[model samples]
Target chain A: MTALTSAVTAPGVLGRSRALVRPALKEAVGRMHPWVGEMAAYSFGWCEVGGGPAVASGGKGVRQALAVLGAEAAGAPGRAGVPAAVAVELVHTFSLLHDDIMDGDAARRRRPTVWKAYGTGPAVLAGDGLFALAVETLAGTSAGPAALRLLSASLGDLVRGQADDLLFATRPWAGARRVRPGEYLAMAEHKTGALLGCSAALGAVLGGAPPAVVTGLDRAGRHLGVAFQIVDDVLGIWGDPEVTGKPVHGDLREGKKTYPVLAALDAPSPATAHLVTVLESAGDPAVAAALIDEAGGRTAALAEARRHVAAAEAALAGLPIPAGAADDLRSLLDFLVCRDL
Target chain B: MTALTSAVTAPGVLGRSRALVRPALKEAVGRMHPWVGEMAAYSFGWCEVGGGPAVASGGKGVRQALAVLGAEAAGAPGRAGVPAAVAVELVHTFSLLHDDIMDGDAARRRRPTVWKAYGTGPAVLAGDGLFALAVETLAGTSAGPAALRLLSASLGDLVRGQADDLLFATRPWAGARRVRPGEYLAMAEHKTGALLGCSAALGAVLGGAPPAVVTGLDRAGRHLGVAFQIVDDVLGIWGDPEVTGKPVHGDLREGKKTYPVLAALDAPSPATAHLVTVLESAGDPAVAAALIDEAGGRTAALAEARRHVAAAEAALAGLPIPAGAADDLRSLLDFLVCRDL
Candidate 1:
């Protein structure tokens, strides 16, 4: 049967693929120092390495699985490639840890953020340590010179993008009054998409996939990240607390210029104007929910997200993926952009 | 003449070597984008690319010279190794830029620090940019895998050391009473020694020197860094402001627990006890300086610095250095720890 048919008919392929990748991640992480392994286990919602009960829960681990699957899809699945997968996860964790600090967020994964638990200095060090470890892992990989360069360059982009985002947050006046959609897309690409690109690219680099396949996978990941960020922004305002671990309309209250806000800002409406006004003040749930709904902001943002998802799918269409891999990728993309509380 | 003899005979060798390294640094820096080049020129006291006069007078550029001369001492003195030399300097500058911010230092190299000039955000981004650029350069080099690993590992050590230092600083319990000399040495290793070791080893890496020789250079660099740091601590309390660019007795006033301070704390005399008491209190320069003087802290610190300098010299002994290079190295070592101001 075709991958699409298997995905539609059986649907177990997704779970099975996830099962395949999860062990690789666990085995790879087990190699870290006992303390780092414990911290990581806690970070990932695996068994409590900290003497707590063995609670198993986490954000999808989709990025890491994607890295493993990406390598497999390109026809190189082995013990050699697992470290790159670990590296990707480390980079992802580093970003999340630092982002929590930068955003002054207190909770993560149903627990206190690293900074809240360990204090800011150690948290920063932990993040930095993880980042160092990530790059260091690549050195031992058989991925060779070109891959190292690509990884380094992608990291540079990730940090640069983050710098831009932080700068925008701290000094909005420095940015243009109305950022073009292209600029928003670029920002998303850097801040969110770059690591996903690294995930795909690192996989392909390790797998020794042809350049064309690598490029396609990279494009696929970029679009997937863009779609993911848009949906994330939507969920930020409209998501349920149970699902997101964040209060509804939190981003709106915080005056975040998410895609929805940017989209609404671009096309002026009375509702958008109201949003702009209330944005300066914190939005209570009733007012925020109404403002988001009345402006058709969530709907517009969903549509935008779908567009990027479709683009991502189209990009993946060109890749010469292995058996069952395509279905897993498709399912992963679907899971990334489509859940609600 | 031997390096020791020339040190007493001709101090100009060190000065001339410094001159050679300066223009090479300027040329390499000039190749970056106009904005970065401009910032760097202002930082390095070079002329603006658009034919204007120099922005500010440059400092000693001692780190870059160390890298170049160290490489030359290993016997490959050509431009082939210059990229590594340039890269080491960039890494040093990146560290200094961030360190200045972290330390809340206002002046560096007789000019406003990057943080002071461009605000914290830009300064951080610029430092990050330099770091990325340095890695990119090293990755692009023809240097072997071992060399890249060494450089990357050094950078990691630098971060780890820095993280530990910051953690030590912020921990409320880590004051004079709690801080230890070992901790101070560890901080110095990370903050100052790691890069110096990298600088010395880069030459051997480029020269394809035997592993033993490289290890010897590394050991030499570490001892030299310790000696340099001890002298720096001495200067912080007793050096002239015209040379050090900060007030005399600055470390005492800042309540910094340097090696000397920690030593004093270990076995307190009456005056040492009083100095510690003042440091524990307001850290007023007038009171602290008087107490430090009464304690004969300057003489004690100088004696300690002399011991380390001797150790550094001993570490360099027996290495089959190129003719005249050893003498120059010895001279530089003496000048480093023997600076009166």
Candidate 2:
């Protein structure tokens, strides 16, 4: 790793990415009907619930950062990845807006979710608008076709993941219908990994990278996504409310089929039986949380997350890119996986 | 018009389009999660609300037929246009699925709407799935990038049109906020015409036509869409329930800002004031409908429809296609504008 790569922190890479992507995204949003635009602005954390300016800005730009980094790794300037950055970010926002409505979530990032802030219809349309822009953003560019194929396939995986998650809600906690551990992992990979994979691939492709390099970056991002999702799942179950800005044991209370719960349920420990009973009977969420911990769910989940991260790291090692960019990429992935709630 | 053109009836053109597009459409839907696939099947009229195979096999396939014909007009075989046909049809289905949920509509094509049959969340996913497939269908083909760009822009127009329609619901029947006549027509063009325009353009592009011919065909479709929309507006108000499969005066009852009502409100006749009073006071829908008619709203709307149809015919006359295809195109447009509810 070069001194410049060491000096360039994760936040710096992310800031640079946002600098390039935000303007294009803003222009796209500005072109929408004023009503839908308001909802989209609110979803992006740029406005208050009732439509005034907000200071919070938006997401951490993880996908956008990855896109920029992927470009840099391909020996192109980060600006070369702006279209992919904008597109992936747009898709991420679209998914978040719709998911909030589908999951009946009221709050996110310590603020009201888009559906809760606006009406469900408006939120849905806003999400659709963002999606439309995402596709247009790619198709309007010279490098659009390949990236669009990646995006289209990712959408299928996303819907499949969401569908499986919704279906899991109806399955019994302690019967043959109970979701399996491998099923939970597959869902996580599909729901979260696919977009991350696409973002990396799209960026490299946009940066004029060859197909082999794009495929390698895609694999790295996918593994990293699974690791990141596991961290999120853990936070949902046991993170500090003040830090996560979320209620404690939310996954348990909502009966979410998360990684930790599935891992514990698959454990050979006797505590697994008690965990199922608590979940099935709709008992105290805290009790279920404790039983899951006692059954080694926490350690198992963390271990699984580490394994994926290792896989991501291995994928990154073979990439023929600037060694400095590769180091920065590893550091960024590490930060994502090891972040606090 | 050539003899072959005269012999090719609207139904024949539509039937051939369906025969080519349906199998492709079926295969795409089959790729989704089974739960979402069921809802999509229901939306396409391939299945009942509860999931059994149904007698009703879907929409009129007018967009698909236009796509096929557009390709033929570009001097290519109709089969070359199947990708565009499928893509446009997919986008149409996507709009309908989301629109049903947004509009709170209960029935379409004499069956329960997707959201009404399944839950809103499931229907939303199903719409998104169709949208995903639409993009993929384009991107997977050689003619993808340009067609995808057209589709993306059309989505923006479609959303803008819908947003305007939704916003109009909050406007007063008799005040400064009353929807303007020009605004309503623009909204109608956006909501009803954009995808139609895209369908024609996409087909010609897929058939290897140059950009100028694509633009001309797009304009023709746009005019036809406005004419088709006006006819639909009239049917909503006055068409027999048995034929239309809709409640009588549904637009008035639902306070829809349709072309006829906007025309009536804009008229110089004294009866316009009475119509406004009836609408604002929430008086009987039938009374409002009759007053709107008495003010010549129906005549005005039909006249507007005829003008658009004429515009469409004029645009088609300049096309560089085989004369037979042009004649067939005009005949199809005529059938769409002239059909009974």
Candidate 3:
């Protein structure tokens, strides 16, 4: 476990898959409208403000690694998953580009979000371009239509999750109209879980895995997604802004019904009631954070994350895959949950 | 020719295909998120302002007809094209939904747009949902990977064209930065042609046509799209508001660089110079419209449309399709260019 943790801690795991996926992803993006391509580069952090080469590259490429590793799990050449890795990464990029605009987030990766760097219209158009590139990345290949279907269906889930997230924001903070934990979980699963599942499913399918293995990886990925989302919810409320590359306590400020907020509100206590009152008036995010943590939301959330991680582990167990691949997938899963930022 | 014109005037051609595609399209739309589904209904004119049924239906279903007729031309049963038809139409709707937002359009089809009825975020999300559904509609079917690839490739063209269109709006009306006629034609063909071409190509591929015929229909549709766009450009300025269901001379006011504007500007006449002056100061759209007409822009545009229409006819002439199917396709082409609105 220590060795695995250290391996994950070195950043090489994410960087390895990121290196494989980035070239193909950039090529696909380069084939789009040139202006939109520039915006896409900015979205990926391959370029700085004026489209120069970036000092640092983009995200951790977790989904890409899931894809690349998912293929390896099926005993295929890990490179066989490049297309799937590119597709999922492109889809993930597409979601972030649009989500930033819809969520009105100003920063990502310690820089302005795409919509903040470019205007909303261009950002949206670039996002659409990435989405198209995602589909084309798979369709252009010899990958079966089933892989394309897996990718496409997840897109519906992604948008629906986003739509529900937006709608939940407008709902009241208390009473019948209040967003329930179960409902939020469902939305999170759709928004987050579906894509992760699709990433693994796509790779497994393309790698010529049997239906059972493909479906198993998909299930495992989905459970991992739930755990990953819980971690994100925690980071959104409690992580340092500099570390997370976003405004800290944003979920509290946005009045978003993240799992912690819901868990805190769900508990019936004087502090809980006071937390609701503070949230109702759009109170200080710090105070809201304290109230939520004081109500045991943090502990409850960590427990739930562990539960989901266990479920993910259970799904991963008994899979007809090589032992080495299983270890890699488990390590990544552990890294995602335990990630501080 | 008179008889063909009368047949095209009857509206039955559009209606026939519309009826076939509606149920499947509706069923697809119904499977989406309910709230987003309602917004899609509003987008399709399936429902009125408040979610009730509309007396008037949606667009003429030209793309759907292209797909269906394209399959029929390939000697398959017309129903073989249904999935292709649904996919193309969904893509079309997705473009319009997003385009309306980008264009800041408030009224479409004499009613408030999705963004106007719903908010910008919801409308954008609904458009994205429709796009996913479009891909899913094809991927869920037994359509060959080729058909899906054709559909996927065209999305890149569609978004690129759209991005260029937006960028074109901000360019100087005259200069090196001026939107050139050739460039605009290329943009129009992409913005308008790619999907139309894909519609025909999807149908042909799904209907088991050989590559030659599929490629032929794609070319024919691309040419027809240019003609269709020229006709639209003409109407954008000179057509009656009541008949077009839009503000008359809206393109002139919006400063959109349509074919007529480019042509009128290209002609080095006093009227053309005055047209430039008027446009620069944001003079009356009526005056600009008259100046454009005086500079022979209308005639030149019509001639350009006729040339593209002839090119389309030539592309269709030697295709290995049924004679009856060819005639039906030709009739639709003619109807599209000769449409009043």
Candidate 4:
């Protein structure tokens, strides 16, 4: 482990970042057209459907925290990162809206997805609106042009990653070409890491950090994002539905080729073969999980997640970030990847 | 009619604009990731499915022409407008992609729509990618910040317009909440006019035009867009399928609440009442068309189109546009509003 990872995780960092970002996000989204603003509010859990009062519960705001921590690491005020934080959250929400439609996901956060609550058309428009608003918000900042470019390029990577995910899902595993583990990692990086990296880089830029420091923060973000996704893949099968706000073995039941399942498939053992057979047959989730566990899939996934976390710390080690801010980021990384859900 | 309108429409002006904008659009889209780039190419009718070679016939490039004309009006070379032109066309294409999915349109330009051919998921992503690419392309220009702001605000208006349209379509029309003619026009202004206005404004800004000139050009573009939509409503019910690349009475059959139909419904005549009844019952397209025509809906729509065109001309008249550029714009406006399809 790097020196950064060895430091104690900072308490209250996540909550403090949320405190800074939430109001800013609300203001930016409020500036949208009424109808879209309402939809966005609902999507963000700011208000109940049909413009009722705020409900308050929302996502973990990990990206927003990262943005704040990144800015602080460069010795800028936490408020200096608000625009980047809001922008990143908006992008994340936009992706969720579209992804729910594309994946036919019915629930998110234990509630009906936007596409389910609102029609597909409105949901699509709302997502588009959020994306435009994100760019608009960033463009209004002092770092407008640079931030816009970074976010736009990150969006491109996101779409490509989603396209690859869909393509891989549809392609047969027995085909002449199957998605390799490396390709999956690349897709994860593009899909999840790109935006996180952008978020950090944007904060660093907003803080007026030097190029090398910005690049280092970006790399750190990418590593954390990869680790986050790998941990998510593990949770998809083993996580408590009450905690995760998702069904147990959700990914396995859907035959999702997530890291653990893919790793199990790559393993050369009878249990691995059995796991593949169970998956192909749409067997029970418990049986599939047991088979995967017997094949050491869970262990391998956990190891991979740890490896990424270590890499994330290593990326931060050489950076010129202040010690306190680095500890905050390390805390964030730990909270993200080491969560039970 | 202006002296320019009295003359024959410039024989190759549209063709010339297409030639300039198409290559620039292709190059910009080429800069996108291969997946989205291929999808964009296919959507633009530049290629067939599965990454085939270029096939070519695409949109009318009206917005591209307007961009170039706006630039020339500001005394810049037509090529100075290429980036703005490409950006507008990308925005237009992005709208088409989403609109097709929302409207369940199976074909466009006599070929399968992107959503129909490529599935809803990829189509949505492709639209998103195009939007990002549009802003990205604009951001690369010297007028990047201003252009980005214009396009982003225009996008917000576009989403609001789409939302209003969907809301109007779903709402009952017999009560105090019936969609007013003014509201429909406003929606059209938001949905169609905003981007066209941005396109012109962008061109003017790119050409280093004065602020007043930019605003005037934007107003002219908005009027032109309104006129174009009104003309399209007239043709939707009356134009030959062979000419419009749509089924005869296409809008009527689909029960689209276009300008003409709304005008007919608002008319104080038995024919108007009968048209409403027919529409409510999903009556035959021929019957609905006959009722609308008898109620003078066609005439009213034509008048509205002409009024908007005149307003557009008046907006142009006050600007310091060179006489030749003014004439070109007037001729283009006439072509747009007077065309059969």
Candidate 5:
């Protein structure tokens, strides 16, 4: 294997892709109206809340990296994937802005979210502006029509996922049956996997790849996305606050119906009953975590994530891509499912 | 002049166009996910909030009419413009859904707004779904790219306008200078005119019109849009509630910074001072309306609306459309400016 094919951490791949994608992403955001642009910049961690100087704190550019890898796997230059990369990143950021408002999340990446710092009205408008800008940016690319269609369809899926999430979160837990694992996985596929699948498919289409290659990348990305969300559920319960830049057990505190919590509730054990009791009241995070662990929820979730990672890797095996590209994808899959934070 | 060249009432033209466009618009909205489709259908007054039977209560379909007229003027069948018409109407409904949420509006068209009936999260997702579906629908059209670019750019303008409206509404009235009429007009242009211009441009482009014809139609649509907004402002203050389906002096009751309100503030009259004082506190709608009328705000706004209508009509004069098409446009322009509701 080449040096580029060697196992690399998630942050390492993110850093390399961020170096290439951030400039174009920034430029695309800069095209928004001045006030909207400022809010978007703040949301992206490119600047402070009041807009003084750059902060450079942002989420890992996993989607953009996937775009670049997908394009390269299709034998196109990474630079040729810049527009699709930027488009996906913008859509991701747009969802974050609106989701923060809808979820009533006050902070992200250890800083006050846009809605918390500015106001809900401005945050909503800024999100809408980013969405429009995403379409506008893709419309200027050589594969404009195809990319627009993919992005638009992905957006619909994202909205549907969000709607389902909201409905599931508000269900009457006292009398309601435990949400099935299949239902949770389906929602995750829509909420998290759809955009990732679009990211890969868009890059491949823009790179002039064959339909088979696009379909393969999309399936691989979807599996990887599900695995990523499962890992996120794990981290939400037990992650180190310092490393995650989020409060430990934050999702538990918010009473979120994440994968691990759902799994624990669905488990046929006395510990599951205790976990449910704790979740229904103001139980301490440590006790709840212990109950969930004793019920085998943590192990079950981790195992499911591994299964998805394996499936993702299998999906890429038949694709006519370079060995190095496949190796990088496998590394990403591993990093995603195994990350500590 | 032929019979088609004769002046027509606003309802006459609206009724005709609504018959032509509503079927296509309904089908397009019906293509969304079932839940989202239900919310959209409710918002459009096509069904009840939880979805049982159809109850069609909707806007006048003015933008869709303008789109179809634009294409027909460019010598294409009106049916050929259905996709663009549906696209523009979906975008308009999307704005209404989100704007109603941002503005905390409880009711629209004498019924509960989407956010009020179905909850804010579902309303937002439904709006987003409609937006994505708009782009998806347009992507299937022959004029997909150009139409997409126009709609995307118009959406950015609309968001900017909404942002400014929120900023203006939140400004402290104690020491701040009065908002100028120019600023209000500019905001209205962004809020209303951009999409109308895009509708005309997209239709003309779709119909294979020359560049100059498209430009002419865009300019005309913009002017007509401004006039439409001005009339809406007038209706907000003094129109009969039975006709407008809103409370009399609704804008005054809500302290909206509309065209007439801004003009009243700028007028050099003792009523202007008193109106500002009343606006700063809990003012009676009847007194506020009287003060605005006495200050000549109503007259000034009416004059401005007429000027825009004249400009809109003049723009059509130089276009290479059939006389009947030009007459229809002029009739629509006149109807828009002179409407009672």
Candidate 6:
């Protein structure tokens, strides 16, 4: 298949996907939660009746793209990936909803976060509903046993990753030290990579790809997930506020022990000392940003993120897909991990 | 099958269930959020491994038992309900973990609560793990489509009910003020009944019982769940400390809007005024208990529970099964909704 135009590739896939996903997502929402239209519209950055743009934001739908791409790569030709993509997206939505609540995050997609808008109770309930809807939808898939296992295992990782994140958050002992690159990669893999892996895995499985091909796609997804996370970490700390729709140095302000801080900590500098003290102090964002910059933390963090992205790109070398498909996938990875948004 | 004598029955079904449930529950604890175990252990009445003779301290294990019994009633026969039972219990455990944290309740099953034993973060993660594990286990169950659907929908209700409960707590508006008995029943049915329904439903589906039988069993489970919650409400107010292991009028102390309180609220009087005032007020448990008695709320709650028990009994009528099995089920309901401990 010819590679779609660069500008249109993602939007094109999402546009096609929205057609399939919209109705299923709507029905699933109804089945799973009350005030479904309102919550979903608010979540998707659409008005209650899809009236207009609810927010100036949304994801590139990369994971759903993986599900779609995996199915194509596995030779299920036309849109067999639709159902799997919807299910994967639902799980992703669920994770985002709950994670925001747990972290007390107040914004998403340049708008009030689910918990912030609807309160924690509704946010949690909506998340749970999405989770159930994901599983229920997966069970309905024609891909059958393999699809079931893939989705279930992915759900497990989602929880386990969440557990690790929460554990890392509260356990001073666990997170006190700066994160090593390897450890950071592993955390990223668990926290984000696993679901992407499931996305590709489901696509491959449902599309009837050979076992080795399935394995290759899974690895590709893991690498992609890690890369995505590292990029996210970079954006979290230093991305332009206009593009990212978040304050610069947000992570430092939150005292988040992301890759750069962890890397910097290992160098045994006074900055590390100042940083720790700053994190302990709970100052305003300006103070936190000043401290982080003074420490030269942002550049170091970006370098670490770059290293992970390089590694992720290297993992894609083994896939035997057609050249255009491979390039599209590569471009997608770069777009995700390097974009301003 | 011949009816087992009560002497024989005590150690037969109940005894074996204890044996089955104990080890599984242990394994579950071992595997959950590692941070949450200390708190969870305390809530489960363990100071350490092999801690004090495992208190008959846990609930009737009604949720789990319903799964087990449902399996039999539905015909997957011996022990097929175990997985579903385990899953339902995990859901139950999840609720309790969060409920304690939410209510700031300091004790459970006669021991320090999860949040009390460990801390809020660990407690929340622990509860979250249990919720994850519930679906995780069901993924491994032998019951095909039906069981999966049953379990997923059950979990959906459990979360939604929790949301409702939380919403009610935060906003006690007129709807909340005049909370009808039916609404209370609906709440309990959703919060409590749904899980139990899944339990029984799993059994019937796995057991290969006909669809009608499964439907009948589901209705019975709903009645049983309502009966259980009402009974629990009664125990919360006036049951013996030795038997209940919780503080007398503990629900009232927490100002939980249970069925009895709602019933009295509907027909306002000096008693209802006092009861409502105490619930709306913030003070000591002793003061609250005194107000409950002054309002004649305790007796009314108990009477209401008995009414529910009778309704529960009526729902079990004409279930297609051997007389002895039906009798055992009836006795089991009594053991569930009527038992002191």
How would you encode candidate 4's per-residue C-alpha lDDT over B134-200 as one tens digit per residue? 8778887878577788888888888878878877887654456767677888989889988888888
Better of 1 and 6 by DockQ: 6
- Span of 10 residues, lowest total lDDT, candidate 2 chain A: A1-10
Q: Write the residue-wise lDDT of candidate 5 on A200-261 in tens digits.
A: 88888888888888889889888888888988889888877777667788888878888887
User: With candidate 3 superimposed using the best TM-score fit, by how many Å does residue A15's alpha carbon deviate from the native?
Assistant: 1.4
lDDT of each: 0.67, 0.85, 0.85, 0.82, 0.81, 0.67
The digit string of per-residue lDDT tens for model 2 on B1-341 reads 43344345777878888998888888878877888888888888888866787877588998998898889889999888898998889889999999888888888877778888888888888888888888988898898578888889998899898888888898998777789878988988899888888888889999999887899889888888888999999999999988878789888888888888999998899999999888887889999889889999999999999888888888888778888678778778867875542
Report the error of model 1 at residue B115, Å. 5.2
Better of 3 and 5 by DockQ: 3
| lDDT (tens digit, per residue) of candidate 3 on B1-341 | 34467366436656877888889999999999988999988888888766787875588888999998888989997788999999999999999988888888887777788888897778778889999999999998887588888998889889978988998888877767877778888988889999998898888887889899999999989988888998899999988777776678888888889999998888877797788889989999999999999999999899888888888888899899998678788778867774432
Q: Estimate, for each residue in B25-106, the C-alpha lDDT of model 6 and write its tens digit.
A: 7786676545455445555555543243544266556666666666667545547778777777877887787766655678
Tens digit per residue, CA lDDT, model 6, A1-341: 12334455655655665665567566766675455335655676655323455544556677777877777777675267767887888888878877787777787766778778776546655666677677778777666556766677666666666766765565441244534556666767877988888887787777778877777777778877776776677677767778877778777766776765665555446666766666667666566555555666666666766665666566667766666556656666656665432
Q: List the residue pairs that clash in candidate 3.
A: none
lDDT of 5: 0.81
Which candidate, 2 or 6, would have the higher DockQ against the true structure? 2
Score candidate 3 by lDDT.
Answer: 0.85
In candidate 6, the residue pairs with backbone N, CA or C atoms under 3 Å apart (3 or more residues apart, or in different chains) clash, namely A178-A262, A179-A262, B70-B203, B71-B203, B75-B207, B76-B207
Backbone clash pairs for candidate 1 read: B3-B327
Quote fnat for model 2.
0.67
Q: Comparing 1 and 3 by TM-score, which wins? A: 3
Ranking by DockQ: 3, 2, 4, 5, 6, 1
Weakest lDDT window of 10 consecutive positions for candidate 1 chain B: B168-177
Docking class of 5: medium
